[model samples]
Target: MHSVDKWIEIAKECKYLPENDLKRLCDMVCELLLEESNVQPVSTPVTVCGDIHGQFYDLMELFRTGGQMPDTNYIFMGDFVDRGYYSLETFTLLLTLKAKWPDKIVLLRGNHESRQITQIYGFYDECQTKYGNANAWRYCCKVFDLLTVAAIIDECILCVHGGLSPDLKTIDQIRTIERAQEIPHKGAFCDILYSNPEEVDTWAEFPGEDGFWGAPKVVFQFVHINGLKLICRAHQLVHEGFKYMFDEKLVTIWSAPNYCYRCGNIATVIDFKDADNREAKLFKAVPDNERVIPSRTTTPYFL
Candidate 1:
């Protein structure tokens, strides 16, 4: 068995693990994830986060602000990889934490978790550049396949990577999805991961893809029918780090600060003290002087 604690330390430093260690880590986490349902159930006193997008330093800052896992439970609503520099380290750290403390954290699938999406984004290239092969990327994708599609916090707040899907009505519908594969082009599964909340009167087609842009009425209907108090999702960039929509019936949490390294957006996570009482903890990206930026051919080291 690999020492997950050691791997956590290494990943926090923004260093990729050796090929063997990474493979083992993936295998370990995969076994743990395989037991999770498509719609996993989580308790409160948990920190709910949005997209990390491979911002490893910002993720570290998030831990600092919201409290670390096991100590402060977390439910990360996907997009763990891609769009940022440290996809490998960012994801590896989370995987390690999951393996070490499965009950304390929940990781849901984001639209970007798909193999096609990662290839088009940045994760595929990051793996190849870091390991001189696609093995690492493949291993991570396997974990992505097993990642839960959505999570319910304390049986009230519905958490998904994207917004409401037109094809699905209840949380049970989400539970029926076979999530152990690459995300499909259309249908409830795809829509759950790709849809977005909009201000329109009803559900609208999201341009260029299988997702939908949902309106306030759509959200209200879904929440009412499902007996849900709120729908929490993350897919769009909210410069404020978090945004409440449809009269707080739904919330969009964005945890990647200064997205893409220049968007100037603050990151935030929701800390649920209990099922009823929750707080939004906001944080900024780690300063350049505080983090090590690795070169294309070198491991990261403190400046």
Candidate 2:
């Protein structure tokens, strides 16, 4: 393993790491993530963050407001790449921190982490552009496959990138899911990663794809079966940066402030303390300063 200082240096500058270093970092992190179950168990007094979406500056702003790794245990509900300008930098920093403090950081898989999604969104192109090749992108996808699907905080709050799955009624069912593969088109895995609670009933179905019913019923069964009190997720955008639905039985926390640099929405993170208290901290997108802006031309990636 490379020195922690080397990774920290790369993170500080948001520099494009060499291909070898990137591969090594991904390999190390993959080993750690592979050992974790689909329903990763975590303790309290940890801050739960939502979708990052490559908003590296906002992520830095998050650390500024919430504190850095090891100092504060963090559960990142994922979407660490795509849409924003610094997918490479944003994800690499989180991976480095996870590698450094494996027990301090919990990185879950978001819908955008998959190969098909990244290629359509921004991460794949960002990796290719940053390294002048696809090796870095490939390495990162391997790590993505290893990322956990969800986390149970204090055995009460279930943190997932998306909401409940019809096929999965219990935490043990979720554990039976075979991860480490590309996100499927349909089924419990894809549903948890892509389905939304609000749109479930009204969702249009394509061939071979199942229809999602509604948030309330699904969430109730999931929580009841797992013996959990709440479910936290982050696939939808909320104007206030967070939204409580189904009588606060489910919460959606979105950390990508001003999504796509145009949504004009706020971002938030929820801190869960040991005393069984949950506090939601709201923050805004970072100012359009030169330091935080991407140096390379980012037009092609979006196209």
Candidate 3:
């Protein structure tokens, strides 16, 4: 096994390691994640973060603002890669951290983690460009397939990348599904990583996509029947750092500051304490003045 410290150093610099080394790292981490259940259970006194979307510098800023690994028990609600310049760095850093401190961190699979989605978005191309081959990307996908779909905290809060699914009624149901595979087009697995709740009383799909429209009442019934106090998710981008709905029973937290580097939105992380207390720590996007953002001519095809 390679040293996790070395990978951490490479990640701190936001630099990609060699292809062979990255493949080794991915294989090692995949072995560990394969042993985890679909619904990973976590205890409280932990911090929950939202979509990262490959904003590496912002992620570094997040660690500085919200506390760092091993010291902070973190449950990252996915979207770790895609749509930013440093997908490889962002994901490998998180993967290295997981390998180093598996007990201190929980990595849930996001919609972008899938091969089909990444191919359409940016991760696959990013990998080909950065590594000169698709091997590293393939290895990472193996790890993605092993990631858990949801996490239950303190037996009261349900944490997932996306909102609740109509097909899901209990946390046990989340665990029963076989998780080590590609995310299906339409199913509990896909829903767990893509569903979002509608803000209005009247339900409507997102304007140009086959989207889901869920309500506060839907959230209430799901939590009530399952004996959950809250549902914390991060699939949708809330302009505000965080949003509370249904009288604070469900919350959507977004951690990617200045989403896509243009959304002009702030980010937040929720610290879930052991005694049922929740506190949100907010932060702004790191200024990108020093970075040269190129024009969209060479941008990924999905954009």
Best of the candidates, TM-score: 1
Instruction: Give per-residue CA lDDT, model 2, range 122-240, as digits (tens).
Output: 88888877788889999999998989999999888999888766677688888989888998887888877776777344333434443354457667767787788888989888999
* TM-scores of the candidates in the order shown: 0.95, 0.93, 0.93
lDDT by residue (145-243, candidate 3, tens digit) is 998888889888899988766687777889888888998877677777877887766344545333566777778888899999899999878888899
Q: Using lDDT as the measure, which candidate wins?
A: 1
Give candidate 1's error at residue 165 in angstroms.
0.8
Judged by whole-model lDDT over C-alpha atoms, candidate 1 comes out at: 0.88
Error of 1 at 282 (Å): 0.9
**Which scores higher on TM-score, 1 or 3?**
1
* lDDT for position 137 in model 2: 93
Worst 10 residues of 3 by lDDT: 202-211
* Model 2 poorest 10 in a row by lDDT: 202-211
Off by over 4 Å in 2: 199-213, 295-297, 300-303
All candidates in order of lDDT, best leading: 1, 3, 2
